[model samples]
Structure formats: structure tokens, C-alpha cells
Target: MPKHPIAVELEAINRDGETQVVRDCGLPVQGYSVYLRAVEASGLALATWIADYDTIGPAYQLAERLSIALAIPLTVLVPEPLMPVQSGPAATTGVITMAN
Candidate 1:
């Protein structure tokens, strides 16, 4: 599966003076990309960097839904969270690297 971009709020305040802390509530723009078929025939590529693997699965799931909901194709760059490796350190290495 693919990963979704995050929705982030860069500043503490907008022109309105109040800033929206969407850290948990939303994702950063770089975290996800929205591709409209009508706009681009090939569609947009999924993002490779993500906030965490924890949300990778959900991001892909959302992409699938968006594809159907918006009638456009969406791809998530990150793969779904995998089961813990029984090998301990060896398996954890990849997870840690990707997280970074």
C-alpha cells in the first residue's frame, strides 16, 4: 500500500491572528498529495517520507477511499505497517531507519 502526506500548519498564527494546531488533527501538505484525473492524466506520485509508520496504513486506506470518493487515483508512498520481526534487532533496524 501507499502512504499519505500529512497536513501541517507551519505558523502559530495566520492572517486571522489565531493559529490552528493541526498536528494531530491533520497532516502536513508535504505528507500527502491529491491527484485529480481530470487535471493530470498520469496522476500524482505518492510521497516517500512520512511522519511515522503507525499512520502509514491509515494513510493508504484513506487513499483507497479517496480514489473512490473523489473518483481519482491516489497512491501512498509508504507501505503498510508490518508485524514485528521475531529477530528483534535485525528486523527493528529497517523500521527505525524508515521512521527517521
Candidate 2:
């Protein structure tokens, strides 16, 4: 069966986020990718991104690219939310909360 990218990617996100990593078959990959495909109520894919991995360089780059691709802003929140607020796109607008 040819697994849809959205389904495969969503499984990876749910697994990794809950377990903090994907573990199965004893030889699990060290890191996983969160491929987000946001679609509207009309079944149109609005945006997508491979987010929040150990190698943030790729994710970060993808965020930037996806922002342009989707015409929607991308944002990231630091772990230390209490830190002094520095003005930035991710810091100010486009609030996204992850459950993990």
C-alpha cells in the first residue's frame, strides 16, 4: 500500500511528540520529522512544514520556505517563555502551542 504522506507524517508527529521519539522494531531512527499539512474546512491543503526536529537547520529553513509557499507566517516559541521578550515574528505574532 502506498501510504499517503500526510498520514505517514501525522503518525510520526503523534508518536514522536508523545514518546519524545519514535521507537519501534528496536532500531528506531534517532530523530523524527513533523510534517504539518494544514488544510481548510473545504479540504484544501493550506500549509505544510517539517517542524521541530533535532536538526533545526532543516526545519527552520523549511519554515521559512513554507511561509512563502503557503503565504502564512511561521512562528516558534522558545522553551523559556518567561525570558525577556525580544521582538520578532515568532516572538510576537503567529502563536502556535504544541502539546508534548
Indicate which candidate wins on TM-score. Answer: 2
TM-score of each: 0.27, 0.35
Q: What stretches of model 1 exceed 4 Å from their correct place?
A: 1-53, 79-100
- Which residue pairs show collisions in model 2? none
Per-residue error for 6 in candidate 1, Å, reads: 18
- For model 2, residues 1-100, the per-residue Cα lDDT tens digits are 2222221121122323442323233333333354555556556654334455644345445544554555554443222221233456643433343223
Candidate 2 worst ten-residue window by lDDT: 3-12
lDDT of 1 at 68: 49
Task: Give per-residue CA lDDT, model 1, range 21-90, as digits (tens).
Answer: 2233223322322232232234554333222222333444444454445443343222123212235342
Query: What is the TM-score of candidate 1?
Result: 0.27
- Model-by-model lDDT, in order? 0.30, 0.38
**Model 1, residue 86: C-alpha shift (Å):** 22
TM-score of 2: 0.35
Q: How many backbone clashes does candidate 1 have?
A: 13
